[model samples]
Target: MALYITDECINCDVCEPECPNGAISQGEEYYRIDPNLCTECVGHFNTSQCVEVCPVDCILPDPDHRETKDQLQRKYLALSGQATAV
Candidate 1:
C-alpha cells in the first residue's frame, strides 16, 4: 500500500529526504505524499525509510490506495526506469 502523511505530522523535515521516490513534499500546512510515486520503498529499502525517521509516526498506509507487494515492486521498477508501468 502507498503511504500518506497524517495531520499528526510535526513537519520536522525528516521524512522528505528519506523518500527514495521523491514522493514526499511540503504541503501548505504540512508534508504530503504523492501516492502515484510512493512504492513504500519496495525496491529501494527493506522497510520504509520515511517511517523509520518520522519523529511523530505520522506516516501510515493509504487504505484508499491499497496495493499488493507485486504491484509495489512493479511501481518501483517503473519509477526507477527499469521497466514501463503496465
Candidate 2:
C-alpha cells in the first residue's frame, strides 16, 4: 500500500528527501504522498524510506490504495518508464 502523511505531521521535511520514488511532497500544512508515484520504495529500496525517516511517526498505510507487491512493482516500473501504467 501507499504510505500517507497524517495531520499530525510536523512538516519537518525529513521524509521528503528520504523517499526514493519522490512521492512525498509539501502540502498546504503537511507532507503528502502521491499514491500513483508511491511504491513503498519496492523498486528502489527494501523498505519505505519515508516511514523510516519520519520523526513524527505520522506516515501510515493508505488503506484506500492497497496494492500487492507485484502491483507495487508494476507501479514503480510505470512511473520510471520501464513500462506504462495499464
Candidate 3:
C-alpha cells in the first residue's frame, strides 16, 4: 500500500529526505506524500523509511491506494525504469 502523511505530522522535516522515491514534499500545512511515487519502499528497503524516521509517526498506509506486494514491486520497477520481473 502507498503511504500518506496525516495531520499529525509535526513538520519536523525528517521524513522528506528519507523517501527514496522522492515522494514526500512540504505541503501548505504539513508534509505530504505523493501516492503515485510511493511503493512502500518495496524495491528499495525492507521497511518504510519515512515511517521509521518520522518522529511523530504521522505516516500511515493510504486506505484508498491499497496494493499488493507484487503490485508494489511493479510500481518500484516502473519508477526506477527497470524492466518488470517476470
Candidate 4:
C-alpha cells in the first residue's frame, strides 16, 4: 500500500529526501505523500525509506490507496520506464 504522513509528523524534513520516488512533499501543514508516485520503495529498496528515516513515526499506510505488492511492483516498473506485466 502507498504511505501517507499523519498529523503526528513533526515536520522533521527527513522523510522528504528519503523517498526514492520523490512522492513526498511539503504540504500546508506537514509532508505529504503522493500516492500516484509512491511505489512503497519496491523498485528501490526492500522497505519504505521514509518510514525508516522518520523520527516521529508518522508515516503510515494509506488505506485510501491500498495496493498489493504486485501492484506496487508494476508501479515501480512503470515509473522506471520498464514494461509492466499484464
* TM-scores for candidates 1 onward, in order: 0.95, 0.92, 0.94, 0.95
Pairs clashing within candidate 1: none
lDDT of each: 0.95, 0.90, 0.93, 0.93
Runs of candidate 2 exceeding 4 Å displacement:
84-86
What's the lDDT for residue 79 in model 4?
92
Lowest summed lDDT across 10 adjacent residues in model 2 is found at: 77-86
What is the lDDT, from 0 to 100, of the residue 3 in candidate 1?
A: 96
Give the per-residue lDDT digits (tens) of candidate 3, residues 1-86.
99999999889998988999999999999999999999999999999999999888889999999999999999999999996567
- Quote the positional error of residue 43 for candidate 3 in Å: 0.5
- List of clashing residue pairs for candidate 3: none
Per-residue CA lDDT of model 1 for 1-86, tens digit only, reads 99999999888999999899999999999999999999999999999999999989999999999999999999999889999645
The lDDT-based order of candidates, best leading, equals 1, 3, 4, 2
lDDT of 4 by residue, 1-86 (tens): 99999999898899998999899999999899999999999989999999999888899999999999999998998998896467
The C-alpha stretches of model 1 lying farther than 4 A from their native spots are: 84-86
Q: How far is candidate 1 from the true structure (C-alpha RMSD, Å)?
A: 1.5
